[model samples]
Target: MADQPPIPFHRGHFLFGSTFSLLRDSLGLLRQLQQQYGDQRVVRIKVGRRMITVLLKPEETKYVLQENNRNYGRGRSYKILREFLGDGLLTTDGDYWRRQRRLAQPAFHRQKLALLADTMIDEAVSWTSQLQRLDKTQPVDMSAALMEATLRIVTKTLFGSGLGDQTTRLSQALNDLNHIISQTVLNPLRLPNWVPTPANKSYINASGLVTDLITGIIRERRQSTGKHDDLLDMLLRATDEETGEGMTDAQLLSELVTLFTAGHETTAASMSWTLYLMATHPDVQARARAEALRTLGTRTRFSADDLRAMPYLTQIVNESLRLYPPAWAMSRLSLGPDQLGAYHLNADEGVLISPYLLHHDPASWPNPDQFDPNRFAPDRSADRHSYAFLPFGGGPRLCIGNQFALMEMVALLGQLLVTFELQPITSEPMLPRPLITLRSKQPIRLYLRDWPV
Candidate 1:
């Protein structure tokens, strides 16, 4: 029942709180407390005018994200993201989020996913085929390679046929955007766009590039005589429930940016980490490869139904996500006074939810650091708190494209691992850089052996 402020002695003035260090080493600070303060309800970290409360337990995390979700709002990280992402669901709250969520929800429906499956398999084949062209002695920088594959998957899913290399252009633009954002997220004392810092200039340039690419696609679609069977068409034709009108050009651009960014970035990171882990662990790799090879031998294509049948493949993915979820941490703002377990939170206080910390909690996960896919076995998983594992988060604000990301990974990883052996050329363990997404701090190099390395 000890509901007090977080251990508040960082190297900062009392009134100013721990501003710089909070930005520079956020997760480091949180994980430091995770082991020593087991089951502690809330620990407060002061940031500027706000007392940021960090939640470590599943039950408390569940209450903020789900049961009392109404009393919380999207907080800091998202607010900073708004500068680049605009008013997409990730940044907006209240009625607009509901409307946009409803309008875009159908794009990721199970039926819609089936439509995208053949294309996904086809793209995977083409991508891996090119890798075969590379000399085996030449190690691949998987971080970049995965981003290219994932960006194409997202674009094809949304735009369908007849768009040539637009996905590549968009990918480069987003890559530049990611670098600019990394600096912004890491350095809390941001210079405004007018101040003309190098990062600010890069962001403006990247933002313009994204806007131009999306607007061009919209213009081309409008000029065409036929309706395409893809997300862009669906979005173009969607009508608001009350207004009976489609989205404005600005709204369309915002949603396009949101979906395009969200759909690919995290999935690519997850795939990269999963591949790195498998490459480093022979037994884990063999087991996953066995399931995939059995499921899809001598076949280049994987149907949507194939994903459902691969239990071990699914478990491997679940475990990789446990270790390196791309959306590693989430933030929320208190809408009003509230109590979570024994801790009392004030109105407008920022709350930090670190799934990266929760997934590693030894109290819930025995031998937490070890990689074991069997942790996701139905019986074992059922006994754990529902919120104990939140790679895609939970409740009403759960990632809308969770299924899309899962389906993409299952199809791509299951098929690719069967075709190629990912031999890690990077050191024994990879280091993570937590930013807009969880990414490898350095290029994760892996040799793409034809198999049985």
Candidate 2:
């Protein structure tokens, strides 16, 4: 057999930077590559002296995410997740992932999620009320506030009552855990799980506390005669239609952790970015507010049904997601040799599909860098390819919580707009730091201008 031509590799100045610099400035580096090579260039990125191939194109993204999904499995990027999530849906591949997906699918059923609307709205309103109490003289970190709000909603929806004080501790622990995971990704030394470095120890302790909380919730729900139709209850009662097998306690715990982590963080970041965008782009904000008022009619609270009725609000959220997909890039390892474009992919070689690059491609989107919610209008969206806007990704392995996240955003946005007028505290651009999810490097500082109403 003839030897295949070597894939073009670009070695640049940034490749020699410190490991922390490479980790912290990853998005900037990616942007530079996009400019130099255009989308779909295979560049060699250095992470602590290790060179990893980075693929950035929509066609390649579709090939990796949809067409050859089974041939690829979640790669090294998810190793940090497996420690805490324990081979849950997001980190697992092959038959294990398939089985877990089947077991957890019913909990996120549309009808069940519809019931969660009130929980989402209540949490949003509660958080907004706290924000409103802040003195207008001071700036509020809307980023942190949004994170807390989304965390509360997901926690409540998953575990039901008695989480008031526990939620605060859990949120702080999770935040710390997220930071540790991001740091660990940059340092590639293989360390035993029980090594007990300060960061690792913290993660272990946090994981234990969270697991205990989830187990207690499950036990309490099982013992109670009162019916709570929330997700945890649904997960507990869910039986596989094919084999009638139920998820074991450990399986359920792992999934609960996955949902709490993946579900809340991404939704929080999306909503935070949406608010930041709204603060900076007042005109678009006005349109979103007008849409909410027209559909909701001065109501302080919105329901799932009301969210469904607000189409423009949905578009605004969709547009925000396109600009800053929470899960900005996804990675997979080819199980066998395959053809991707003109390049022949090899087994065990990693492939990455960055939604960040695809959604911002100038060809797919005009004035790609600009904030334009109108791009998501029915007429405009109809002209685009289906894979062009993959905030929750495409194909079977698409985020199971996609609908739930959308609902949470709509409910939260509806309440936020009606309660406080958001103003940017600083004009600095909210730069992306692509860790577990894409997050702003600094807190999204904003002034909570009181609504005249």
Candidate 3:
């Protein structure tokens, strides 16, 4: 460890290092650092005594996330996530995570997800109906609406459509908890979850509300004789193939919380960003809508196959994810000393990989900043590096709900475009807010006008 060569680093404040700039504008500082150290595979930034090493190229990213993935583990941020999420797939590592993932994996199978398609399209159509009734002159908060819609879709698909009024309650409680988690993770001085601070107390209340609602539903489902065939039912009946033991109620709670929170949050952000881009780019909007209309014709309901058929609409979603990936920046802690690209990484040092950076690399993606859906068109995408576009991340820990999120986004966007003409309320572009997921700093407001029937 003592004999290793020093890695190149970004210079920051004399005392605090990159802490101030990192907290103020993380993405901007990262981009700046990458440019300052051009062609360097790995660049380090010191935040006080801690050094964060960011992989700069697609090859390095592929190495860490895929080729040599076993040497990396979930970082400290995931430890903070476990405070609220418990030891679920997103938070756990090694054997435990593998076991839980195995138990829950069947629920996300294409056959199972196909059964949930109608529920997703139904919720999206219902949402569009709500938009249709609203005054055309008023600007709608598309961000909040998409969040609510995705929440409902996840809720119904997870626990079934019986959650009539609990949907809003769960949505509010989850939002509060997500906000607290994001703040806690980002704030270096944040108090422990056990602390009696107001923020901590508020977090506890929201967590309790979510727990009560989910547990009550679980208990009811357990006592019922009928089957709903939802994710909850699959989880309830799932057992370990090795031990033949099933998840305990407590284990179920953790997985449920993980699924509920992770399921909708990122997808909603992606949809919101897509809408923002569509509103700003009328040409893209027209083309997408035209494709949707031509594909669906007069039908409002869509099947998974129908969604798969709309390649251009899928491109728009892919490009949106490329621009504003929900899990924008991810971290992994090195398990041991290793060579990554040109740099040697020490055990326990933090390793950062940003899809945001990779997606915007001028070398990999020409006009990287521009919104070009055709970049994902099959012919153009053939030669792109495998890890260059990691919207759902890569390797074994890739998001379990990736396909489900795609189907929902494409279906919802298709339904929306065919029904309404989205008009941006303001010409100013919405800036990305780096929360748990990448979201708009301001509410993405749009005025919806009924399209010709």
Candidate 4:
């Protein structure tokens, strides 16, 4: 065993190792890894007592995420999210995760989320209309705009009655949790969750506010005899086929928080990147707008059924995801010794898979640097490997809300393009920040100009 050649190590400070670089600019570090080590090499990243082997190729990702999926589980960073999401599907393992997946699976079924498309369209309309209140010449922070809009759609879809006026309060709480957790997980002196230090207090307070809000909604729903025909009702009615048991209040709250955070955050990030791509490529934007108008007719709001015919719009969205997958990197812990390519991995070792690297691999994607939506054109995509493009991930644990997000994006973009065209307002280039989710380090600024009918 000792005779096995050593995997390449990313050299760094003796004490901190790759810790600072990983937190500061993860995408850059990943690209550097890919450039220096190629796709298959097992690269070592150690800081303190922790070690992770970065896996950048698709086949290896397929092996861990699908082929022998049971041998791996969610990474350590997920512990921070468990503070907010509890033991929901995203953070659970073994039969528990499988059971939860079954219960929530029916809620996001194709026909069900399809019915919620009108709700998404209505929400988009309300948000788009608010643009009138802003000065057209002023640079709008589209990242915040889309984040707020998607967050509203996700909450409303689950609760039937949107966040309403509590939108600001809930949004701020979530924002605080996401940022605090991402930074806290890296802090060497981070206190325990139960501690009353300033940081701990803030996380607890924000988490409690979120908990109270969800609990109130659940209690209200339980008292009602009428059916809402929404995600919550589906969940409340779901029973374990094996035990005939239902999720407890504590369980339901965790799942609710998971759905609330994961459902909106990734979709919003994708939409932000999409807006930037559209602005930078005027021709693609104009053609996409024209196609959207042509298919949508004069209607201000489009339907889920309407999304089926818009091929170009799908390409645009697919391309954006290729360039900037919201869940840029995911981690899994190996349950046993295994062979990943030529490297042997021991039990309990952490593995990192970067979709950002796989999607841009020149072998799989031609001229990967260019923003060409045609790469997703039906005929062109037919020959590509399924794992090659993983914005929503793949395998049994693929994002349950993928279809919902795609439909929601279509509704938002379709409604938006019908009345407006997005134009880039900032001369600076956009940079990706790989936190809990990938986000722009700086605001993705743009001007929304209304177009004639």
Top candidate by lDDT: 3
Best-to-worst lDDT order: 3, 4, 1, 2
Sequence-dependent TM-score of model 4 = 0.95
Of models 3 and 4, which has the larger lDDT?
A: 3
lDDT of 4 by residue, 89-135 (tens): 88888999999998889888888887788889888889989876788
The lDDT of each candidate is 0.81, 0.80, 0.86, 0.83
Q: What tens-digit string does per-residue lDDT give for candidate 3 at 252-289?
A: 99999888887888888899999989989999999999
User: What C-alpha lDDT does candidate 1 achieve relative to the native structure?
Assistant: 0.81
Model 4 clash pairs?
A: none
Model 2: ten consecutive residues of lowest lDDT: 13-22
Model 2: how far is 279 from its true place, Å? 0.8
Q: Between prediction 2 and prediction 4, which has the larger TM-score?
A: 4
In the range 242-301, model 1's lDDT, one tens digit per residue, is 778678777788888888887778888899888888888878888888888787767767
What are the TM-scores, per candidate, against the unseen true structure?
0.93, 0.93, 0.96, 0.95
Task: List the candidates ranked by TM-score, beginning with the highest.
Answer: 3, 4, 1, 2
Model 3 segments beyond 4 Å from truth? 1-5
Number of backbone collisions per candidate, in order?
A: 1, 1, 0, 0
